[model samples]
Target: MTRFLPPVTIALAALVLWQLVSFIAGSHSVSGVVETMAYLFRMMQQESFWLDVAESGTAIFYAICLSMLFGWALGVVIGLNRNVSDVSEPILVTFYSLPKVTLYPLVLLLFGLGLSAKVAFGVMHGLVPICLITGNAIRQLRPVYIRTAKVMRLSRSSVTFHVVLPAILPELISSLRIGLSLSILGVLIGEMFASKRGLGFAAVNAMGLGDGTRIMAIGVFLSVCAISINFLLLEIESAIRHRTARI
Candidate 1:
């Protein structure tokens, strides 16, 4: 399937290119592909590594869920009103463009530099993309659907849940993919800036100590973690879409 082959092909090509470049450069700064991969395998054997991975994963999941829930609700509200959407567009653009990391200090002060702060930071970054995408998708929904639903005397909740939500789901899934990637990056950076233990923390420490192997290893580990989560989410999204379509 193209779905599966594309990732595998890209991954293989990247690995070959990386190995060639690392080999030719002869500088130990960037690790060779094989060495980094071996280190990643070693990391998988450690219970503590999985625990740290789990911590970051849990925080990311919570943040994304909160972001999507709030964003979708707000987007529907704003999108339903032309005047409100127009007035808020500039403000929303500013928030989206601003770097989320800049607010970490304030968040740290409020949430005290723990999982909560990391999760909150992730939410800020994730919510903007989701909200914008959702709003845009809402605007494209057919007026005919609304008219027909009204003529049929559909309840407000029924119209929204049955019609609006289903129509926008494909777009929501796309936004969700983007939001997940951004949240993962945000969570890792948040961990680097503030956490005691995480893959990001390990990478940071490795960099400071000039442990090039560990640095490369941790980078690979993070990549694998990100890839796995993305794949899992994609699978879940596909399954849900199929089930919903059948209904």
Candidate 2:
């Protein structure tokens, strides 16, 4: 219960601020919290809304899986070799620093407009951070772990799976959490631009119609979902760190 206080307080404060803003802006410009929630509840009752959610959800799921798979694999490879890490680190950093939106045209050109484009855009957003973080974490790992694996005459795959991966599990989880958020953002952006369905499209449509209530409702829904997932991941990461510390 105590653990929940900060977030609860923050939420209440946010609602209060929102109400104040709504009052000042007038109901036409900004919806009150209650009005937004009411609109969200109505949205939830529609089958079309669920279908849009399913579309976005599927894209998010695929993007996350692909990002994790490729990110982890490439990160492991880059981390294990000193020469590769030294050479690639600067390049990866430069690429990651660039605004992902700038690459949207290229992604659309390559993937075309559809779920594939959305997934690819998401991977573009997520993959680099995970790879960079994982690679750096592996580079900073205790040398004794590697020496032990070498002494055991373990195969490359065996060493990675049994030693390196387990050792960097905490860092990996942290990178994953970051990557997941970015992937969701990427997918939503994709939906906003060239997609016909999804929550992002719904939000965009609402914007064009000047429906402040619907727009606020969608924003609130996405914010709450993202926050909940992030909190859950943070808890898991914390647990892993604690267990690792104990060991």
Candidate 3:
């Protein structure tokens, strides 16, 4: 209960303030929390709304999975090879620093304007950070750990599975948490920019029609999904950290 206080308080206060401002302004641009919830509840029963949700969810899911798989492989290679890391570190840093949105046009050209484009956009947004975090995590492993593995005559695979994997598990989880959020953001932006389908498109349509209630509903839905995912991942990360500490 205590852990929930701050967010609950802030939420309640924000709702009250929103309602107050809406009342004073007498404008349709901002909606009360109740109005938004009513629209969301109505939307929950709509088949089309569910279809958009499914599309967006599936795209982001694939993006996250791809990000994790490829990011881990590439990051491990870079971390394990000093020459490769030296040659590629600057390139990765530069790409990661760029606004991912800038790549949307190129991604669209490569993947087309379909669901493929959306998934590719999401992967691009998510992959870099995960790769960077994983590479750094492995690079920072203690020299003693490597020496012990070598002294034990562990095969490369054995050392990776036993030592490197466990050591970097926490960082991987942290990167995933951030990457998932970024992937979702990327997918939504991609959908809004080019697709006729998805929650992002729905939100865009609502905005064009000046449907403040629907806009608010979509915003709240996305926020809830992000918070729930992050919270679950956070618990897992904390558990890994605790176990690592004990080990």
The best candidate by lDDT is: 2
Sorted on TM-score, best first, the list reads: 2, 3, 1
Q: After superposition, how far is residue 162 of candidate 2 from its true place, in Å?
A: 0.1
Put the candidates in lDDT order, highest first: 2, 3, 1
| TM-score to true structure, per model | 0.89, 0.97, 0.94
Task: Itemize residue pairs with steric clashes in candidate 3.
Answer: none
Q: Per-model C-alpha lDDT, please?
A: 0.84, 0.93, 0.90
Please give, for residues 1-247, the per-residue lDDT of candidate 2 as tens digits. 9988998999899999999999999988998988999999999999999999999999999999999999999999999998998898899899888888888989999989899999999998899999998999998999999999999999999999999999999899989999999999999999998889999999999999999999999899899899889888899999999999998
For residues 43-116, write the lDDT of model 3, one tens digit per residue.
98999999999999999999999999998888888888889989989999898888888878999899888889
TM-score of 2: 0.97
- Give the poorly placed runs of model 2, Cα more than 4 Å off: none
Whichever of 1 and 3 has more lDDT, that candidate is 3
Candidate that beats the other on TM-score, 1 or 3, i.e. the better one: 3
Model 1 poorest ten-residue lDDT run: 25-34
User: Candidate 2: lDDT over CA atoms?
Assistant: 0.93
Q: Candidate 2, which ten residues in sequence have the lowest lDDT sum? A: 95-104
